[model samples]
Target chain A: MKVRVHVTLKDGVLDPQGKAIHRALETLGFAGVRDARQGKVIDLELACADEAGAREQVDRMCRQLLANTVIEDYTVEFV
Target chain B: MKVRVHVTLKDGVLDPQGKAIHRALETLGFAGVRDARQGKVIDLELACADEAGAREQVDRMCRQLLANTVIEDYTVEFV
Candidate 1:
């Protein structure tokens, strides 16, 4: 099974990278862009037997190592 | 309107970050993990009027600044 995890900064967190990208876009003539937030995607291939098991393991992975739970939020998707 | 861009490394390209994460997962006891790939996600909030226009602008953003076209591929999504 394949799983995808998306990790994004929580609301109100400062994202300098996203700000920089937004600034770059404006400089490039894309003035319509109002806001930009950057995040991460992790794609995993598992030897697990079922979607439920994969989700459980991946969720644990996220909680333990894949995400900074303090400042970021993550969502897991089966692909 | 909102748009999302997912940027991922092309197949056969080496990803040291993903490897490190996989190793860490194994050390933490998640043995079912077989492979891991890492990518970036950019979420944009635009003042654009239509989804079509937002997609066009976001695609340009990906091609120009959000993604490296040579070793990475990006997908744009309307949200």
Candidate 2:
């Protein structure tokens, strides 16, 4: 099975990298761009027996290490 | 308007960072995880007069700088 995990910083967190990208965009003539936020997509191929098991395993993975729950949240998708 | 751009390395590209993360996941006891690929999501809040203009501007940004078209492709979404 294939799974995707999206990990993003929650609102109000400071993101210097995103800010740098936004500034770079403005210089590239992308006007009216007010703010920018960055996140990660993790694509995985897993040898799961079934979807339910995969979801459970991926969720645990997110909590334990893939995502920093104190300031970030994650969503999982299975394919 | 809000827009999202997803940029990813094309298939068969070596992703050492993703590989390192995959190894870390395994060490954390995430069994059955076969492969992992990493990508980025760029979220922007823009003061666009219309969606079409925003799309065009963002497309140019992606082409010129936001993504490396040589090794990456991007998709844009407006909200």
Candidate 3:
């Protein structure tokens, strides 16, 4: 089974990297972009084939390693 | 309009960051992980309201700024 995790900064947190991208886009003349935020996607290939078990395991993985819980939130899904 | 862009390393590319994650997961006692690959997600808030126009603009942004197309592949979607 394959699991995908999305880790994103919570709202109200400042994202400098996202700001940088927005600036670069504006510099490049791509108008109409009001904001941009950056996040991470982790794609995991698991030997285990059970869907429920994989989601649980991958959720644990996110809590333990993939995310900084104080500022970032994570969601796990099968992909 | 909201747009999301996913940028991922092409297959066969060396991803040291992903390798490190896998090693850490193994050490942390999570089993059945065959591989782990990391990618990026960028969320953009655009002033444009037309779906077709926004998609086209975001696609251009991906090719020009959001993704390093030589080693990365990108997908753009409306969110």
Interface RMSDs of the predictions, in order, are: 0.6, 1.1, 0.6
Candidate 1 deviant stretches above 4 angstroms:
none
The residue-by-residue lDDT of candidate 2 on B1-79, one tens digit each, is 9998889899888998789889999999887999998999889998987988889888988899779998998999886
Model 2 TM-score relative to the real fold:
0.93
TM-score of chain B of each: 0.96, 0.92, 0.95
Of 1 and 3, which scores higher on DockQ? 1
| Candidate 1 structure quality by residue, lDDT tens digits, A1-79 | 8899999999999999999999999999999988999999999999997888778888889999999999999999988
Q: What is the Å distance of residue B76 in model 1 from its true position?
A: 0.4
For residues B1-79, what per-residue lDDT tens digits would candidate 3 score against the true structure? 8888999999999998899999999999998999999999999999998998888899899999999999999988787
DockQ of 1: 0.94
Interface RMSD of 3: 0.6
Alpha-carbon shift of residue B24 in model 3 (angstroms): 0.7
For every prediction, compared with the true complex, DockQ reads 0.94, 0.83, 0.91
Q: Name the weakest run of 10 consecutive residues (lDDT summed) in model 1 chain A.
A: A49-58
- For all candidates in order, the CA lDDT equals 0.93, 0.89, 0.93
What is candidate 2's lDDT per residue for A1-79, written digit by digit as tens? 9998989899999988799998998887777989999999889999987999899999998998889999997989875
User: Candidate 3: lDDT over CA atoms?
Assistant: 0.93
Lowest lDDT sum, 10 consecutive residues, model 2 chain A, at A24-33
